[model samples]
Target: MIGEPMPDPRRSIIDNLNQQLDAFFGAGKSVQVIPSGVSADAPFFGTNSHQLKLRAERDKLAPAVRAEAAKGVVASVAAKNLRMHVKRVTLIAQENGFRFADNP
Candidate 1:
């Protein structure tokens, strides 16, 4: 196996996002880590219009609805001790009234 390309040890952005989805949907399976500098164009499992609807509706919601949604997300994160650092960071951001760049 010498000089053969070894698998990347780092996770990719898509994998991280899928893990978040899995976690949100009750963590059925773990995401396989893809190596850095690798490209994976595969679609995710359990991806559906409902997820898209939720994402779209989030932006159209009023400020109060958004705040309530943030609270709900924070409450869920607080209730479950998610191992991902990004999830914890998201919880922190939610508590601090900040959001991911994708959010409105």
Candidate 2:
């Protein structure tokens, strides 16, 4: 496993959506995807018998979302076009689940 690259985090749906909301409205404006009408572990079951919800964070999420990117070291790549980025992670996840869904 030496020299193997670590998985990119920005490619995550939730992270992208959060960044989008933040880019649109500024930090703390980001939202989180929570399990709705379903247990927290429902996604592990591979069942469509659950629901997901997007909720705005009541506290500051800037640190959580921007820290890795803002760090001035080699880890700073996240701050770049990575410049941009989930979710509405559930909605996107659903789209991944049901690919035929319309974007609009």
Candidate 3:
């Protein structure tokens, strides 16, 4: 495996996004991550129609909803570091406007 090609980081991020969304929204929800390169056409991470709906619903709730969502996202990414070569992970909670303590 010395000369094997490294996995694409974008693909890894997309896969992580899908798994995290499923865990947050339950098994049957449709969630996908579309990766576009470092170009202007790249879409924001969670701006799909289904995600828009979920965000709208969450927005209607108390401020804690946003914090919880951020925490979940950060936790999901951090978990991936266990099996993958994650260089860094950062979690920013919008409610308190503070970042999580980095473990690395």
Top model by TM-score, which number? 3
| Model 1 bad stretches (over 4 Å) | 1-42, 65-104
lDDT of 3 by residue, 5-72 (tens): 99999999999999898797895677567575554665677777897775565345424434533464
Output the TM-score of candidate 1. 0.22
lDDT of each: 0.53, 0.41, 0.52
Q: Of the pair 2 and 3, which is ahead by lDDT?
A: 3
In model 2, which regions exceed 4 Å deviation? Answer: 1-3, 8-11, 27-104
**For every candidate structure, what is the RMSD over all alpha carbons to the true structure, in angstroms?**
21.8, 29.6, 23.4
Evaluate model 2: give its TM-score. Answer: 0.18
**Tens digits of lDDT, candidate 2, 5-45:** 97777678778898787787774455568666765644654
lDDT string for model 1 (1-104, tens) is: 99998765565667888878978768566668989666556446545678677555444433533454455554344334333345445544454576544432
